[model samples]
Target: MSFCLETYLQQSDDYEVLINKAGFKDCARLIRFKADEVIYVKPGEVILGVRIIGVPPIPIGIIENEKKLLIPYTKPCHGTSVVELPIDKKEIDNIRKLAI
Candidate 1:
């Protein structure tokens, strides 16, 4: 409830970016180190109320009994990284709702 992906992306500076200007593959590789399972997402799809960015079929990692949704947020300069920030149940569910 406290961590909203949409709002965090806009209003906060309290998250960690492991890498920048990278790609989904890099993020996915990093996820393996932290998450228990991974959910691959199709390109041009929305999750956590935002459009997922990747080549195609991006990977989303979940952990701690689905309490967290690990998403790879990509930008033109900051390519992609597994956003290591706390998220709520509703946000996790939204990502599940759009899972491939």
Candidate 2:
């Protein structure tokens, strides 16, 4: 997939930033607390067009009712952010396949 998270965030307004400029642990905790279901993925997995980085078993939150995904997005200077974005069933399935 050629999806670029930076480009998407810049070009689109379809996503929501739940928590921004926070530490990785804080973001991870938010996902676990807010999400309907949680899935663990290995660090460096390509999710929503970005490679997630952090400790092992990175948390990806799935809100089935909203059809949305919550993920921690990290950048060098910006730290980590929890982004909630709508996703389709196919994409959700694909993400589930990568779960550890």
Candidate 3:
């Protein structure tokens, strides 16, 4: 079964936020998420089960070493943030499937 990103965010507090309320470019810079790891999806691509909202073809970074998911979360009022949250091995595999 596939894990939903939105559901996970709401139901689980196990994740960690590396940065909050920051711009996408900044987040990309900080994490240095490997270019290969970045997944280009539609602005509203439903990852896992979460509708990933961001600029078109948003950049989602993954760090293999830390098993962290680097996502750019955007809101109209606060701008976007680079969030680094820990994910399980299964979830990681699912994310890789979404990348294209």
Q: For residues 1-100, what per-residue lDDT tens digits would candidate 2 score against the true structure?
A: 5767778889999999999999999999999999998999999999877788888789999998899999998889999999998888888898999989
Whole-model lDDT values for every prediction:
0.71, 0.90, 0.69
lDDT of 3 by residue, 25-56 (tens): 77666555443367666766666567777656
For candidate 2, the lDDT comes to: 0.90
**Pairs with steric clashes in candidate 3:** 4-48, 4-49, 5-49, 6-50
- Cα-lDDT of candidate 1: 0.71
Query: Which regions of candidate 2 fall more than 4 Å away from where they truly are?
Result: none
The candidate 3 region of ten consecutive residues with least summed lDDT is 27-36
> What's the residue-level lDDT of 43 in candidate 3?
66
For candidate 1, the C-alpha RMSD (Å) to the true structure equals 3.1
TM-score against native, each model: 0.74, 0.93, 0.67
Model 1 CA deviation exceeding 4 Å by range: 1-7
lDDT of 1 by residue, 1-100 (tens): 4434678767877666666666677787887677876777788686656777776667787785746657788777756767866666776666677667
lDDT of 2 at 67: 97
